[model samples]
Every structure is written in C-alpha cells, then in structure tokens.
Target: MRQLGGTELKRLHRSWRRKDSFRLALLLEDVQSPFNVGSIMRTAAALSVSELFVSGRTAAPGSPKAQKTALGTGRYLTWSTHEDVATAVRAARADGYHVVGLELADEAEPLAAMDLRRDVCLLIGNEDRGLSASALGLCDAVGYVPQTGRVGSLNVAVATGVACYEVRRQAWADAPAVDSGDAE
Candidate 1:
C-alpha cells in the first residue's frame, strides 16, 4: 500500500464536504501573531467554519504575513472584524451560536465534555494571555483542552485547531451511520 496521491486526496476532500453539516464559527480575540492567525484560518477552512470574527488586534488572515501561512485557504471563509471580544460574542450569540471560550478558567470543563454537536462559536484569546476577565464573562460556556504534557498551555493556533476539530468530531460521532455506497 502506497501513500494516496493528490487525486485521491482531492477525492477524499470532495466526499468530506458532503458530510459538512455542522455550523461552526470562531472568534479570535487579540491573537496578535500573523502566523498563528494564518494557521488557524487553514484549520478553520478544513473543519468547515461557517462564520469567523476577529477582534482586539487579532491578525487578519488577509494580511500579507498571514497569507504567507494560510496560502489561499483563508479566502474559503468570510470573516468579519469587531471592536472587541464582547461585541463579537454578542454577534455570535445573536446569530444562534452558543459561544464557547477556550481557556483554562477556574470554571471551565474539559473541551470534549461539552455538547459541541450544536452550532458553536469558539472564542480564542491572545497568545500570552488566555482570556480577559470581561471576555470570559461574555462566553456562554468555558472549555479547556485536557493535556497530559508538562506544558502549561497550548499555542493559540494549536488550541484553535484542536477545538475546531473536536467540535466537528463530536458532530460526526453523533451522526447516524450512512452506507454511502462506497464499499463494494
């Protein structure tokens, strides 16, 4: 067995798009590094994020530096900019998304424990600081990625990717099985 070629990879992507039913949104709150933002944008596109909102000086995916990392995948999403996390949170909630903040807060539950099968907006904060007090207050739920490593926290981009994937994973896991007629 050999590695799948580009054609095979493309075929897989095409099939996954058909199962992309979850409504996922992301709110980047003051994630300063352009590279991080770019990487998160790539993950967001792969996981089928329907809405993206950036605020508080988070690097825009369309910026030159970010584009260097995101390539053209960032264009697959339509993201908006907001003044701050509070406003972004309000907007996300108004759009029928249950905003979940990714942080190691005192009250946060394990990320995987949350019911992410529904429409969810993940709020990620700055690289150095996890989330502002006011911003944390704005979240409908707070969740953290349970880690076994010695590291205190994950990189902003990495955490975003993991959380986004978790949301999709939950949805996919809870879905009813379909034969899809692929097997002979």
Candidate 2:
C-alpha cells in the first residue's frame, strides 16, 4: 500500500466536509497548562468543533507555549476567553446548546451512552481538580469516558479528544448516507 504525499493529503482534507452542521463547543475551565491548551486546540480543530471557550484560569490561546504546541492550528480555530465558567455555560445555554461536563462524577453517564445528537457545549475542567462543583451544577448532563486501565483517569487533553471523537462519531452515524457514485 502506498501512503499519500503532502499535496495529496492536503487535497483530501480540502475535499472532506461535514454533511451536517453539528455545533460542538469546548469549555476549558482553569486549565493552567499552555501545552494542554494548545494540544486541545489542535484536537478541536482536527475534529471540526465549532468553538472553544476558555474560562477562569485556563491558559489563553495566545500564550507562546500554547501557540507552539498548536503549530498554527489555533489560528484557524474559533476560540474566546470568558470571565468565568458560569458565564460561559450560561452563554452556551442561551445559544441553545446543551452544556455537558466531561468529568468522572457519581451522576455522570458513560460517554458512549449519551445522546450527543444535539448541539453540545462540552465542559472540561482543570488538570488536577476536574470540574468545580458550580461548573458541575451548570451542566445539563455529565459524561465520563469509561476506562478499565490501572490509571483511574486520563489527561484533560486526551479526554477532550476522546469526547470530541464520540460527538463526531454520533453525528456521522445520524447523518444520512450520500452516494459517492463508485460502482463495479
């Protein structure tokens, strides 16, 4: 099998487009690491998330370390800073998006089981504390990635990637099939 070269890969990416406009927003609360912010930006851009909102003490997208890790992807993403998590959550809800928190809480449902077909504002918290109590209270629902490994939790960036993928997966599954015209 042959691998696609840079030009071909770029062309492939240009040709790919989402069939449905699934509004997926990411809310980062008090995530201090610039590297993590950048990494999450990359993941969000790659998955075509509609917007990113960084709140509280989360690192800004303009941070040097974050920009370095983002490798220019941050420039292409729609992101903004909010005064606090509550305001961000309120804005998302006001805009008709379902605010869901990505945290391992007793009330959280498995990520795979949640119906992600609606517009979602996924709330991810700080590296150490996860979502704050107030943040959790604001979420319409909470979801957690089920893990069986020795480690009880995943890094925030990794968890964001997984959750984004799940959202996209469900969107694709719900989308009507289109014929590409390939035939024998």
lDDT of 2 at 53: 86
lDDT of each: 0.87, 0.87
Error of 2 at 21 (Å): 3.6
| lDDT score, candidate 2 | 0.87
Model 2 weakest 10-residue run by lDDT: 175-184
Clash total of candidate 1: 0
TM-score of 1: 0.92
| Candidate 1, residue 56: how far the Cα is off, in Å | 0.8
What are the models' TM-scores? 0.92, 0.91
Query: Mind giving the per-residue lDDT tens digits that candidate 1 earns over 36-73?
Result: 99999989888888989999989887899988888789
Q: What RMSD does each model have against the real structure?
A: 2.1, 2.7
